[model samples]
Target: MNTTDALEAFALTWTGDLTYDVAPSLSCHEVDTLATLLRALGYTAAADAWITKHSRNDDEGDAHYVTPAAALREQLADASDRTPWVELREEEPDAFAAGHMVLHAGGRNRFAITEQCDRPSDDPDRT
Candidate 1:
């Protein structure tokens, strides 16, 4: 699929109900292709996060899983890089602030993005 098509497919898979599971089973090549497309579309942070979360290091001699949030944090914390997730911050403020970006995995090799709540969890009115 083309970059726009891939992005559209990714967005179409988004879910708002956090209680419901959202995982897209994709191959390693698919993951790499998707990340590359995202980077081409100016989603550098998301692309890097995807790569970091999915990359397997043979040198380590064992597979290690990194959470999407952790990967995103690492990318955003890099001082040498330009501002990351500018479009995401403007488009999805709650998710951006909560460190919940597109393409997150609840388990190894499965990934999806969910809509985040804007309200504080401590608020009794929030459901």
Candidate 2:
């Protein structure tokens, strides 16, 4: 399924429960799509944490079997309220503002966001 469909399916079915044991099982692609959607909705930290837990190798076993960190759970809970999931469903992904972060999954499933350098340079020497 496309990312939007995946996202809508997740949002519609999610029970708002942060308990890992109760968390819904998702395919690797679904996990990637959810993480990408979360990042698009500006919940980068939660997305990163969720992806980190779920993207382990098969030998490592599924991390979803364990409870998520309290902070991660809190982040997810907060994000659920703040994210415009319904509105996003109605809009195309391309409609996101320029430089918005998008998650890309690859070998080993590392998380990366395109940096939007709107703030002044951090290096004092540069100024």
Residue range 1-62, candidate 1, lDDT tens digits: 99778766664443122112211244456656766766666666566545554543212332
List ranges where model 2 is wrong by over 4 Å.
1-19, 22-24, 57-127
Candidate 1, which ten residues in sequence have the lowest lDDT sum? Answer: 15-24
Q: Which residues of candidate 1, in runs, are more than 4 Å off? A: 1-26, 56-127
| Positional deviation of residue 102's Cα in model 2 after best superposition, in angstroms | 34
Which pairs clash in model 1? none
lDDT winner = 2
RMSDs, each prediction?
15.9, 16.3
Tell me each candidate's TM-score.
0.30, 0.30
Please, what is the whole-model Cα lDDT of each candidate in the order they appear? 0.44, 0.45
User: Looking at model 2, which ten-residue stretch has the lowest summed lDDT?
Assistant: 84-93
